[model samples]
Target: MLHLLPLRTPLAGLGLCVLAGAVHAQDTLTVYGIADMYSEGIWGGGGRVSRLQSGGLSGSRLGFRGRENLGGGLNADFVLETGLNMDEGTYGQNALFGRQSYVGFGYEPAGRILLGRQYSSLYNLSSDFSIFSNLSNGPSSAVVGGFGGYEPVRGSADSSTGNGGPARINNAVKYESPVWGGFRFGVLGGFGEVTNDAGGNRVVDAYARYAQGPVDIAAGYVDDRGGSVTPLAHRRSWIVGAAYSFGSLRLRGAYLAVDDRSVANQDGSGWWLGADYRLGVSLVKIQYVVNRPRYIDNARTEGLGIGYEYSLSKRTTLYTGVSYFRNQDGAGLGRASFSIPSGITSGTDNDLTQWVGGMRFSF
Candidate 1:
């Protein structure tokens, strides 16, 4: 058995698991976090953001998690993660523990079933082929609408729950299968908690991946019927990506397509290619990505980025990188992941450039 303190103010699905249990001697708890900051500037007329900022290379966050063994190949676990804005001394995500908060059960041979707020399989699958790990300031987030709902391209919260439901689904149930020979899969569904409307604001996602040897490949899909009342918020998207490595060098690429079912003319399609080379504690990376508006003329977006990172220790590192994007033909695409409190827009036809230097600590 396991026991957890009830949340100060419950948010629907939360606190249910805590109320149903008590801590057991077999349970284990631990804390973990990361702090990252950077100094950045644009090439030409740089904005007011020539100063320091948080989350240049990674988001700062604190998390508490634990798991308990229950014999018979079964166990219980939970995670509570809160995003930190090291720059402003405030929370990053909109809500408390906004990064992730969930509870679940695991059956060794079968898989794990989790409930609460958690990432969808589409978000998880991107890690296999996204050289940038879908960072907010990276190419993947600019062109890949399916990278994650938190991307600038999809920042608005769902109307039903007023949350980042599409990025990290709320009131959702998920199942992750055990990996077998570098292969694994998962499925999830976010229930639309509207009154008497089963299809309103419903979201579904799934993915499969294979990671063996020096090669990796993955594909993901997401369908969101944002609001049953209006068809203006619905969308269907998918992505396919693969990577190959030679010695200390790794190369990767991905193709993405999005159907703006709500506004057909705003659909997007694009591809990206990236590479990384690691020399002991030092690493070098580069990538080029583009996005083309489906039915809009002169609205194509593309850019190139290069970066370097050197580790000072096992949990510390200093890094720097530069990126350039030409929003020609009204391409209007820019960094949608990590904004430095300055105004940045995507799907614009203006060229954009930026260089950033920063350090990170992980524990």
Candidate 2:
């Protein structure tokens, strides 16, 4: 069950309580969702697979959010988002609200504190500098492994029980600062939910960024304790990224590193570069990503992806893409993110190639 904090004593005694009540009565709530599907084909070291599935272009999802102006530059806000699979007719992320769920109050020029399951600060900042917007392309791909979301053991993940690791943490408390002169930051921590562990069992993340004119710079770090309640068993990652825009053309670059003290042979680092050109409502995007796992020879992986997207309206878009991956000696792990997760598995095909076509609609 989700817990809510009690109002401060002073605020409760003063007229603030009444004002909050009045504002709460005028709050607004809205329902929203996105649907994306794709046809995908892949040839990997594992095998050749072709299938239709939900793509990660925007990660099909449904959400409900609301806000209430509480006066004095303060406001109450909450979000509940769930991942959905249009093809399987099932909830994608395993939890009732897997994508995001948080409630908090915000101050106009200060910041806000939220409580519940939420996205890592690193992921949020990283997306700002990604041409692919943290999709299954470019340097964002390496982020999966860096954040300890990599499935080195395969088969199943802690988040899904049979898929992969967690993207959002539970029992989390987060703080996000308001932008000041194009500068902002966010921090987060997820308790282990165990009594005896104390501060050792927690997931912590932080990020900061500055954007002005045509240039943007961002940096982030995350220390994940994984599923263990032990302090030393931690997986950590840090990244620095930048993006620049000129007219209709934009360029993005990033360097990411991971310290996998919790897993053997999983420690590694990599980088990515991306570019895109916008022509009215249409865009062409391409990215190159490389991953190097520590202590493993010929066990490196790299990929190149090219994609095109056309917006049909404010809430609809059409997209298609192709990806090619090369896995050195022992590096051909499992699958590459072809947007279509299932169809892109690298089944023993050292050279993994994939094709995808999809459309997304939001309402």
Clashes of each: 10, 9
How would you encode candidate 2's per-residue C-alpha lDDT over 210-309 as one tens digit per residue? Answer: 9989989998887766555233556677888899999999999877777777645367777778899999999999988777766565666687888999
Q: How high is each candidate's TM-score?
A: 0.84, 0.83
What lDDT tens digits, residue by residue, belong to model 1 across residues 1-363? 133433343452254436333333335655688999888776422333476677766778888787888899999989888989888899865778877899999998999999888875545545446666666445544455522232323334533343344557777888989889999888888887777777777788788889999888888787877664553567676778899999999999888776666644367677788999999999998888877666666666676888899999989999888887665654333433344344443333355677788999998
lDDT by candidate, in order shown: 0.69, 0.68
> Residue 298 of candidate 1: its Cα lDDT?
64
TM-score of 2: 0.83
Worst 10 residues of 2 by lDDT: 154-163
Task: Point to the candidate with the largest lDDT.
Answer: 1
Off by over 4 Å in 1: 1-26, 44-48, 137-140, 143-155, 158-163, 228-232, 263-265, 331-349
